[model samples]
Target: MSNLLPEEAEEKLVTVCRTAVGDSLRSLTYFNRFDYVQVYLREDLEQEADLNSFIGNEWHDFKMTQDAYRGSELGDYEYTIRVFENGYLVRITVEDFGVFVTTDGISMQDFEALAAATTEILDEWAIEE
Candidate 1:
């Protein structure tokens, strides 16, 4: 069903996240330009299955960020964390594919770890340039 990573690969990705922080992870949604798949952990997925549509604007925003901050003194892009009243949303992306995960309150160290793990996996599965 996924155009970027296969089911087994998707499972592995989620497993890695689970292992990293255990039950804190609520859901992970993998998305590209056209399609997406949501793997729920702590909550049942609601009626909306359109993860790509939900994040459509974010994709554009991320691209703008990459272009706007090119060559800045700041180091490489790592992760974006959006705080919600109930939990946290963490997004990690590369040039082609990316994933956003929801988790119960987690520490900054855990956030960095998730971002690193995600980026490594993304490199492994990225399309050949």
Candidate 2:
């Protein structure tokens, strides 16, 4: 529902992610400060329909991530990857728009590709805005 992130870009992000991780993808959420889109979710996880609710709680936190390591010894914050027992969580924030993707076990290389593509897409849109 964000003017900065139309349905086409939302679908593009989902498509890029699926192409990167294929069937390992669990779900994807595209969000801005205003609202979020449940871009993709595998059928097996349909019963666990609380993902949006969970994401709602983290909007502020996700926004905070943008300034989190600003001007540190390391370069700017690109993305975040959290490993869990069963899968992984990837968060990429850009200006006011961002995406959070959940995926099953995937290689580090694939994760990097996904993050890079996701960041590039969001960054490009942010520039246009």
- Estimate every model's Cα lDDT from 0 to 1: 0.79, 0.81
Clashing pairs in 2: none
lDDT of 1: 0.79
Candidate 2 per-residue lDDT, tens place, 32-78, comes to 77777778888888646576675665566765665676777888877
Report lDDT (Cα) of residue 85, candidate 1.
94
Error of 1 at 93 (Å): 0.3
Candidate 1: segments with Cα more than 4 A from true spot: 1-4, 43-50, 127-129
Off by over 4 Å in 2: 1-5, 47-49
Worst-scoring 10-residue span by lDDT in model 2: 57-66
Could you tell me how far off, in angstroms, the CA of residue 78 lies in candidate 1 after the best superposition? 1.6
lDDT by residue for model 1 (1-129), tens: 466567788888898788776789988888777767775546554545456566796577778888888888997676788899988888888887788888889999899888888788887877654
**Deviation in angstroms for 41 in model 2?**
0.5
